[model samples]
Target: MSERQQAEAGRVRLASALSASGALTSEWVEAYQAVPRDWFVPDLIWPGRADGVRQEESAHRLADPARWWEAVYSDIPLTTQWDDGEHTGNGRGTTPTSSNSMPTMVFSMLAALNPQDGHRVLEIGTGTGWNAALLSHQVGDGNVVTVEVDQESAAAAKYRLAQAKCAPRIVVGDGAKGCPDGAPFDRVIATCSVRRVPYEWVAQARPGAVIVVPWAPEYGGEAVVRLTVGEDGTASGRFVGSSAFMRLRRQRAERPNSLAYLSGPWPADGVRSTTTLSPEDVGGWLAMFAVGARVPDAFPLVERYADGSYTLWLHDTAVTSWSTVDWEPGRTSYEVVQSGPRSLWDEVAAAHYWWRDQGHPGFERFGLTVTPEGETVWLDSPAT
Candidate 1:
């Protein structure tokens, strides 16, 4: 078989494995079968995981179909950009702007979306047109409108989509505004993660339409949220799974924090769970909330590293206040009491307690409601 054909066979096998394991849905298999990922990916693009510790690596896309398909199907994230927009190639570190999300994650997202044939869809973040191509395959290509902010990226994606013969209307512009011309989409799916659900998405989607996107709290942890737009224009749904996606184009911002505030010790007695809980869960999200709310719009979750070190770095946004506790095996506990006007941990404790009393579950049941300017959450049982 030709190298490209050989790679397709391998990818198909991998997809089959993922499906047999139930990591992917059957429709997802059909989509994968219909769309060849290599078709949209540029012959040469940046690779995931830079070569060295310098935080930067050169773009490397080779001619070997086996290698190319392997890279495409790998579960690890590929870095699309770096240095926060200043650098694209080797030399120094840069932040990732886009990527071909892992196949399993993509399948999970599509499964969550479950867009029916002929359903109108608006996809935000047309990275390489790979995803938009798949969506177009399901819904008529004419029924899809995808928006990307990077002009060069947008142009490249359009050509790739055309080459793939998927003629989704690709727009080069800020996606936050939503495509007004394609208003009332049956499904609105954002490939990127966002700090808040945009009001425009809900407004542009037909009432009761599904909106699927990555929803994270003030902290960096992300949950794939699926909400049904309400007749009042609000949307609500809870997180279904975990995923890491590039941040939305317009949502990029830098907040600073004092590094001194970060180091701490995890509580010894363990967390008080009003709900069934894990130690890391308490330490991770609740701790982040405690720190940020006290620091208010200041301490944002920046870089989280292994070695038991997490950075809640922010600017004089006063987010410089960092609080980090050591990870204790089988023991994740925190006192989280603050001396300032705001008790960050106290609030987290309250949330945990509230959740605990309500049977200490449903972190998954957290639903989303969207308005034009703002978004809110509601508990499924009204208990937590």
Candidate 2:
């Protein structure tokens, strides 16, 4: 076995995955085993952890045994890039491009997709094409169609897919617009994170089929939602679970401070406005789901060395309008405003109220329906 193959993370991971997906369809499980994830990931990539990538430094994907093995095997997602555009993924900047999603989360999402043989599938945000290969194994290579917006990343992923012998028709287009030429798919899955369900997905699905995507909730976080399309193109289902995936390729995710409107005349009052958990958590969740619109897989706050505290700041894209909500205790206060166009907190607070009215319990109660025209999210009521 090649060094990368010998360091097989899937050997153990696949075992755990099989057990976790107890009721998984037999066909799905076999496909999972057939497609090795390492083949899809580059020999060198970043691990999603406490600065797993050397600061402003590059590391070989197979050079370090423990780091490589752990990063490939672990559930934490690795950072692929920063600054949205074609910035070299040399482990610097802000925009995250691609990642080998935590192994279990990948299983969780695929299990949720539940693809079957002959089921035509449409996949969005091909990323590293790992999920596409897995889907191809279950649905047949010819039945899978995957889309990616980044030309460079898409080209690299195309090469990787060839290496793995899994080539689903990869389209270089905006995933927001589902691959139309290959419409009427049996199942559709998105690897990157999403805020709103794309209308194109609704238009592309075969009736009674499933379209699985992640959506941010008003409750300050994101829930991976699975909606089964109706004969009429409407769909609905509950939040399958939580995951943190990147947004669709090149989609500029913005954060809206919806909570401040509830704070009223005083910022202190807003602090106690019912949804006040730690601002770090709330803001993180919002950025993941709403404004920042990142993946809901989740992140941790840890210090690696002396003065190595992680500071997650919520600010305007231009950095002119900025706010502070540090993870530390009582060290920072939020600036909230409700009545203006830029009032980000107010918008979030409104979303919270909307969700609470539907039943403040959790994401389990929420659902969505997408159509060729648009999409709708409702409680109890299925989309169609």
Candidate 3:
């Protein structure tokens, strides 16, 4: 089939899938159809999954138009830039810095924004300009302010927007700071995930404005949080659904090498222990989120071996403590080593226990309350 015909067919399939899944609502249907994802996607891209974490190798349209076209319309994300556009060659980069997000996530977030015909929207991370184009179509170009930190990406998106004849105000600046010139915005949405909901965003938005963003804890689980700003300068809301997007550039975590934790040879200054809770028990995304919420300030890294065994390293952000759990396939108990004042493994286990006892609440049960003091997460209600 021709590229145009393929794109049209893909759109139909995508729209059907999204509609059946309830992500592509009637309110945003016109905008979704109007903004063809192909118009905003670049030729060279890395096709990734819906989770937004892993990517297959590069797929270039010029070299293989069929593969590139297939990737663009599929339900998965398309990584457009890597390592802030610093990496070389056609292969994958060390990190996925920017992307044309998955179609489902894009429309889901737009639906969460609950856009009105004339509502002024402040959008963070204008990676592909497709989202901005959709917003421009929904609420008028003048009412959409899209911010991107990377100059080259912002420029490219601007060119694409120009080609599409949907020119939203694209600002090349820190998205966390938001576009204050477009103050009192009716809605705020972020394409990138954030560890902390930036207070500056709250300050700029009008009361009762909805801010939809992908929020994650330091330990590594993410979800889309819908917060409604209050008159008292507080924004609180429940996590609408699970989501995974690249971290907001400035909010990205500082993950040091595992060697940094070890001062000397193997198990140096470490206390050895064993646990009935297997490493396999605490590996999935939900388990990570549950444990991360209780045990903040630490992150996990895994090192795999050829023998199907792996070591899960737990490190504190302070660089003061570290622990390791060795998991072999079918092992009932795992070998653990700890060093420093805080027993990272014990803390994790306790957090896991706490979560399990709480009935393993899903993302929706978790709510965030962001006030002048700080952010606090609660189960069901803030009082809890």
Off by over 4 Å in 2: 1-5, 8-10, 17-26, 49-59, 217-220, 254-359, 382-384
Q: Best to worst by lDDT, what's the order?
A: 3, 1, 2
TM-score to true structure, per model? 0.78, 0.73, 0.97
Model 2 clashing-pair count: 36
| Candidate 2 lowest-lDDT run of ten | 294-303
Q: After superposition, how far is residue 2 of candidate 1 from its true place, in Å?
A: 4.6
- Model 1 accuracy (lDDT, Cα): 0.65
lDDT of 2 by residue, 11-109 (tens): 556557556656234545666567766676666666665322323433456467556555565555655555545676455656566776766677778
How do the residues 1-384 of candidate 1 rate in per-residue lDDT, one tens digit apiece? Answer: 676666667677777767876767877667777786667666544555322112233434554555555665554345554544566444445456666666666777888898998899999999878889889998889889999988877888888888777899988888998999888799999999887877888889998799899866654456688888888867777778665677887886664433344344532222322222333555454334322222334333335566664532222334333332333344444323132333444444455566656674434756666666676555673233
Alpha-carbon lDDT of model 3: 0.91
Q: State each model's CA lDDT, in order.
A: 0.65, 0.62, 0.91
Worst 10-residue lDDT window for candidate 1 reads: 49-58
